[model samples]
Structure formats: structure tokens, C-alpha cells
Target: MIDWNSIAKKFKEADAILIGASNGLSITEGLHLFADNAAFERLFGDFKRKYGLGCILQGMMAGWPSEEEKWAFWTRLIHHYCGQYQPTPVMNDLKAIVGEKDYFVVTSNGEGHFELCGFDPTKIYEIEGNWFTMQCARPCHDTLYSSLEVAEKLSAAEQGGHVPTELVPRCPKCGGPMDIHMGAGQRMIPDTAAQARFQNFLKTYHGKKLVVLELGIGWHNQLIKAPMMRLVASEPNATYVTINLGEIYIADNIKEKSFGLDGRLDELLPALREACEA
Candidate 1:
């Protein structure tokens, strides 16, 4: 059972908060990347029929027949997930709980929801680069460009499962095709500035009453989850609180200070928010 009162008291006492989120959190916001659900079919039926793609992740990683088709697929995703997104109840509750506290977020999600929901963008470290930005596919330069306007136009102009050849994004200097500034590896530009800021946040809060609030992170995500657990173990004053649906893990070392709540976020967050309010 969740000890709501104890968790509330911990939040009340925290001097700073660091949030770690990944795929599961995005699922709560109704964007399931791994599922070939009805919504996926509705939004991506053409791609499904042509390429036999199962889910969004497959579409992202698939090799397209041409630049026009690739841009068409990407623009549709950007227009729907980024351009039309609104802050959900979970985000609202999280914001309320963080309320003026010194806080930072590290997320593997590239959807940009934290920034859209009024969290200071500088404080969010998108470990995987976000969809709102695009970079040169050849990466001949370091600059990233905004993609929403272009995506909206391209999405509207898509025909026969492909964007117009003229609408395909290209780098200004190199004239090479552009790709989303996400984890496309060598083709993608890294958000180094954000990484520096996240490190600085950790340095500033070294041994204070820090609360590492982990949401929807899976067991295998060593990039965010493993480091967070290490931090909590190393910092005596740091407490770890994790919430996920059907999975909650607390390492033995941090078990005394860790609180793991396993359940659906839509229901859990509101209750936690009320407890924090109390």
C-alpha cells in the first residue's frame, strides 16, 4: 500500500526536486509509441499498409523509399504530437507539487510536454533531443532549427503518402536534407547546453534535501534510472520516490528512504497532488 501521508511529508520537506521520466509517462498522456492501437491505425494507416509498420517507433526507425515520404511521415508525427499537444492532468498535478521549488527534469521522451506545460525549458534536459527542433542530416553545422511551422505545412501538403519534393527540409549551408534533432545519432545534433545545465543543477543541490521523483521509467533504462538510483544512494539527504504502472523498484541500499508506488499515473498523480496540498 502507498503511504500517502509519508510521501506528502517528504515532498513538503524537500528543498529541491529532480524528475526522471521516460516512455511510460508518455503513455499516460495518450501517446503510446510501441502500440499498434486503433489510434495508431487512424493516424498512420497509410504507412502501416505500405511498409507493414507496427507502431510509431518502427516508423521512426524505418528506412523510407524517398526523402519526400520520410518527411511526410515525420511531419505528420510532429503536427499531431507536438503541434496539437495540451498539458494533461498528470502534468498539472506534477507542476502543482513542484510549485516554486528548485526543480529540474531529465527525460528520454522527445515529445516536449514538460516545456509545453509551463516548466522552465532551461531546467529540462531532454536526454533524447525533441521533435520541435530539426538539424542538418549531414550535421555540417551545430545549429538546430524550429520545425513546428514547417511540419504543419508539410503535413497539410502530403499526398499519396509523400510530401512534395520541394517541401522536404534541407540545411541552409550544406543543402543536405534535414532530420529531427532527436536520437538519429551522427545525423542528429546533441543538446550539449541542456546537459551542462542539468549537471550544474546537481552540483548546486549536492547534499541538500533533494527528492528524486521518478515517473514511468522502465527497468532497463540505464541512462536515467540507474544514475538516479546512484545519486540517491550517494546523497544521504536525497530521497527516491518512483511511480509507474505495474512496476516499482527500490534497490536495497536506498530502500529506507525510497517510496515506490505502482499504479496508473492518471489516478495516482491526483491523489499525490491532494496529499501534497494537504
Candidate 2:
């Protein structure tokens, strides 16, 4: 039902493009968000017995109002998603197209898929923070430190049906708890280096015919989406392209310049690629 030919035609005319990824895009690539693996289900049968929840993902999302519980859930999620995952072909293709031009990626996805797919780190602005890194839970610094090694250890321990005491992540210098670099609450720490790069990217390039290509982004977190949409709307030649599974809506003012497609990225991207080349 989505028109890939029209979308590709628009992209071909744009000078720059921005792509944002969300949970739905990740789900399309065989990543189970809430479903427990056989090992986890076996080890933590009590989790299912007590919560009657399908898996840890659902339970965490369901019980995330409390800060402490939310941090625990995010820690586990960040550990698995960033360290153990690889980008899908759709992600790679999007990166390739954007790479051909003067482009930037601003994604709410914490999975670091943009970087994994070869998007220049300097051009990708992660508004949701990254899962591959950890910062002081208190956010003593603006820096984000890598957690890949610790995440691997935790994932291995979880897969082995045991929690390794030494694998528990903690601040290296302070001996305090370490958490994912997220924009939640008062402790949110944005990566200073990434932020600087984002600013530089914006400053160095402005007034160009830009295209903001949003993929699977939802209204649940407006902090990132709203601001990015505003940025795109402010530019005269800017166009906003939103590709979602079911939710497809655009602002009335920019409706003429926007393309809202209700479809999966896996199918749509390939068609767009072929069309663009043609």
C-alpha cells in the first residue's frame, strides 16, 4: 500500500537525509523485545509464575514507573541490545544511501544500529542514548564509557543460566552503580563528544535541501521526535518522510512536503533502493 517509487523520487532530489529507527524496526529483524529465551525461562521460572508475564521485556515495560526497577530493566536491555546485536540489511541499506550524501542520522533507537551499519559516528546523534556505553548513575561527567565487555559478560552469564557476581557493572572509579546513558529523569547524561559533533554537523551544514526520514518512530517519546520534527519543519526546502508500520500522521502545515508510509522498513527500503538507482 506504500508508494516506494514516489518516496525514492523524493529522496533522489533531496540534498541530505536523516533516518530515525524505533522499536518496531528492531522487531522486524528477529529481535524479541520481551520474549524470554529458553534458558532465561528455565532459570527464572518464578518470574513467569509471579508476574504471569510473557517475558522480561514485557515485565520491565509494565513495571518501569519506579526508577530503581526501571534502571535494572534498562541495564539488562542495554547490555543485550548494544553488545550482542548486529544491524539488519535494511539498516545497512539506509546507512549506505545516506552515506552517499551530506547526511546526518538522529535516531531514538538506543541500539547503536547507525554506527554498526557504518554511519559516521560524528553524523549520528543518539537522542535516546546508547546501550553500548554506561555513565555514572548520578552522571558525574558528561562522558559515556563503553560497556561492551561488561555487557558481553552479563549476557554470557545469563545465557549460561547464572549471574556472574563479577560481571555486575559498577562505576570503575567510584564503586557506585553504573547505568545506561539515557535521557530519563535528572541523571540523564548526554555524550559530550557526540553532542559536540552534532552541533558541528548542524553548524557546518544549514540551509540545504534536507530530508528527515523517520522510521518506526512513535509518540511515546516526544522529547526526541518533536524537536527533530520542528527542526525539519523550520527549513524551507526540508522534507519529512515517515515510514511506520501502522501509525502514519504528519503535521498539517508540512503535510504537502511530507510522505507518510504505513509499511515495514525491510520491504520498503529494498524497493526504494532499486527505484533510486533506476
Candidate 3:
């Protein structure tokens, strides 16, 4: 359990809140990346039967048979997760805790839940890109565009787990195949403008009472986790708090100032909100 009073006190005393989130909180909010259930089977039975695919990552891999198959799968993936997006209690709880606080978020989540949950778009840095946008897959261009029109068409028109060939997205600039602007691999592109905004936030409030509230940080990409630890370690007035169900560690210097709450986010988030409110 976490010290609710201290948590509340730190939050109140902090000059600004910096949130860094990974996939654990996302799964608890229903954007499951490694889905293994009847729902996945119902939607991707053909993919499973033909390719023995067990997870969404497998389908998004480089060896997915053909562009047709790849586009079909991507359409469904974006449709279910992004096009039909819904915010969960965890997002609402976070919003409650951040209520009227000067805050900024740098998240790797591509699902755009922060915006859906009513966080200020300008204050949030979607570092990993978003599912609702597309970019040239051939590395031909750096521009990103809204995929809402295509996502809607795909959701409405895709049948038997395949999107219409005419609806398949192609880069308008080079006629190359387009990919969702998600940071899953080396080709992943980051939003430079948003990165600049985040840099400004850091520059403007460097030595203040900053609290790094990290949630569900994973081990794969060091984009969020590594930088978060470094930032907290550098600032003596900073406090680091993490809500992760698994291993959570801190350096010798930051140990006393850090807090850890090990538990499932879906169960812990609402309770955290209650504690903060009380």
C-alpha cells in the first residue's frame, strides 16, 4: 500500500505534475496489445487458422504474407482500438488527481486516450505517435495525417475481416503504402513539435518541486522509464512515484524520496483517486 497522506501532500506541494505512462495502464483501460481471448479469435480467426498468429504483435510483424493481408489487419486493429475509442475509470481517476493542476504528459500510448479523457491536447506529448494518424511507410515523408476518415470507412466497410482494396491507405505523396504513426520499431517517427513543447516545459520549470508520477512503465522501450529515472535522480526537490504491479526499483540517492505502489492499475487507480480526494 502507498502512504496516501504523503502522496496527497507531495502532489499538493509539487509545482507541476509530469506523467509518464506505458502499456500496463493501457491494458487495464481496455487497449490490450497482447490479447488472447475469444474476442480476438472471433475477429481474427482467419489470421489464426492460416498463420497461427496468437497476438496482435505477430500480425503487425514484417512477415504477414501480403500487403492486402497487412492492410486488412491494420484496419481492424485501428478500428476496434482507436475509431471506437472509449475512456475507462482509470483515465477518469487520473484526471481527478490532476484536476486543476499544472500538468504535462509524455506518453507512449498510441491509442489517444489522454485526449479522450479530456486532458489538454497542447499539454500532452504523444511521443510514440498515434493510431489515428498515418505516415509514409517507405520513409518517403515525415508528414502525419489524420486517419479518422479511413478508420471510419474501414470500420463501416470491412467485412469478413478484410478491408476493401479501394479503401487501403497509400501515401498521397509517393503512392507508397502507409503505416499507422505508432513507434513500434526503428522506422517509427516522433512528433518534433510536441517534443519541443515538452522541452519547453522542462526548461521553464527545471528546478521547481516537480513530481514524476510514472504508471505501468514497461521494460521494452527506455523512452519513458530511463528518462523518468534520470530526471528524478537529477532533481533533489523532485519526488518519484510509481504504480506498477511488478518489479519497481530506485537508486540509492532517490530511494528516500521515491514511493512505490505495487498492484493492478485497474484496481489501484480508482482507489488512488479516492485517497487523493479524501
Q: What is the TM-score of each candidate against the true structure?
A: 0.97, 0.79, 0.92
Candidate 2 lDDT by residue in tens digits, 132-197? 777877655555778666656555455322344465566776777676665333577766676787
Clashing pairs in 2: none
lDDT of model 1 at position 88: 94
Q: Please tell me which predicted candidate would have the highest lDDT against the true structure.
A: 1
Worst 10 residues of 2 by lDDT: 63-72
Model 3, 109-224: lDDT tens per residue?
87888887788888889877887777888768788888767877777777765677787888899998888787335787778888898989887779999889988986454889
Cα error, residue 203 of model 2, in Å, equals 3.1
Overall local distance difference test of candidate 1: 0.91
The lDDT for every candidate, in the order shown, is 0.91, 0.67, 0.80
Q: Select the stronger candidate by TM-score from 1 and 2.
A: 1
Clashes of 1: 0
Model 2: residue 194 alpha-carbon error in angstroms = 2.2
